[model samples]
Target: MGQQQDDEDREFDIKWADGAEHKEPSARARMLAARWKENPPGPVPFRGEPEGVGPRWSSWVSTAVVLGSVVAVIVLLGYVNFRAPY
Candidate 1:
């Protein structure tokens, strides 16, 4: 089991050419970056202060949806009548 585990943990060998050269960015990539610098996209806000009770309103909506679902289920079960036959 130890030998099998060692073999599983072993990494495969890779051979790289000695004459390989790193290529610079193309003209199109440079142009796009320059244009973005001139006029960037709008910022995306992940977390910020709610505007005029916005956060509280959304929380109330979520709570209402959950409670409404529970009440609906209870009403549905009340309408269901089951009988046992022997």
Candidate 2:
């Protein structure tokens, strides 16, 4: 039925907004850049993809190291409150 087809099309639009199957580059771009850019907008969401805003072994690791060091310092300070013998 016509109503059912329209519903399906609407559903597809919603899925695309949710980062589902993506669209190919346009013809106008081919004349200009001659390249089909991959996921130019943002991180393409695929199932089972772990948390990442960059490529492998990058800033995330460095940030984690710094945070770990900070926590360690806090824990160590609690063990010994600095109070000089008077």
Candidate 3:
């Protein structure tokens, strides 16, 4: 049996050499970290739940509202400036 080396082991300062020097993690630490590399804690875990509309839908709705308001204002302004023939 032999210890495996991990590739994604990031740089980290750990006590070493009688606590005199601080530098990158040793091969042992890197190897240990690699074991959990596949499942690191960071990204939001998907809690079992039915998915629904996300941020994309929210942005689209807001944009549509703003565009509608602008168009309405422009039409009202033009109507006021040029009234229908009496």
Poorest 10 consecutive residues by lDDT, candidate 3: 6-15
Pairwise lDDT winner, candidates 2 and 3: 2
Model 1 TM-score relative to the real fold: 0.35
Candidate 2 on 1-50: residue-level lDDT in tens?
99999999999988877785666667887655644364345456676556
Which one is best on TM-score? 3
Which lDDT tens digits does candidate 1 get at residues 1-86? Answer: 99877765552211223234765578998898899999986786888677785545678899999999999998787666333333
* Order by TM-score, highest first: 3, 1, 2
lDDT of 3 by residue, 1-49 (tens): 1222232222122223346655578899898799769867666667643
- TM-scores for the candidates: 0.35, 0.29, 0.36
Q: Which candidate, 1 or 2, has the higher lDDT? A: 2
Report lDDT (CA) for all predictions.
0.71, 0.75, 0.69
Native-vs-model 1 lDDT?
Answer: 0.71
Candidate 3 wrongly placed segments (more than 4 Å): 1-19, 22-57, 84-86
